[model samples]
Target: MDFLYLLKERFLPLSLMAIIPIISVILLIAIWKKKDQVSKMMLTFVTVISLILLISSLVLMLFTLVIGYNS
Candidate 1:
């Protein structure tokens, strides 16, 4: 039970970090399938933001991992 809690603590953030791009892609697909122009536009904006967040998070994670590995 304690190990499960520790595992969740370590993995949850990494999993969520990894899922950003996937969620963005799913959002983009949903937006594309939407027929309403306004809804599509809103989702497009969200997709862009999600992409930015995904990229930033990936870069940050990579840098941190490299630094930690070296140390």
Candidate 2:
């Protein structure tokens, strides 16, 4: 069940990274329609949040594996 354990460990961050939809069509539409700065700012914010989630989840996974927190 090592694969299952790894999945559990990595799921949250991977899920967070899955928010690319937020940056997808709507973002393109915003730029195409309004050409406003707000959508650009939102894109940056969402991207940062996604990165933070992935990084934090990776750190947690490393801790669990290296320090044996799941033991």
Q: What local distance difference test score does each model get?
A: 0.64, 0.58
In the range 1-71, model 1's lDDT, one tens digit per residue, is 85465445456455656776677667767776774665757876877886787788788555544442231
**Backbone clashes (count) for model 1:** 0
Against the hidden true structure, what lDDT does model 2 obtain?
Answer: 0.58
Q: Where does model 1 exceed 4 Å of error?
A: 1-16, 35-40, 69-71
Cα displacement (angstroms), candidate 1, residue 6, comes to 20
Give me the overall lDDT of model 1: 0.64
Give the range where candidate 1 is weakest over 10 consecutive residues by summed lDDT. Answer: 62-71
TM-score of each: 0.49, 0.45
lDDT tens digits, residues 1-71, model 2?
A: 98677757766654554455445445555555654555777766655665666566567555655454343
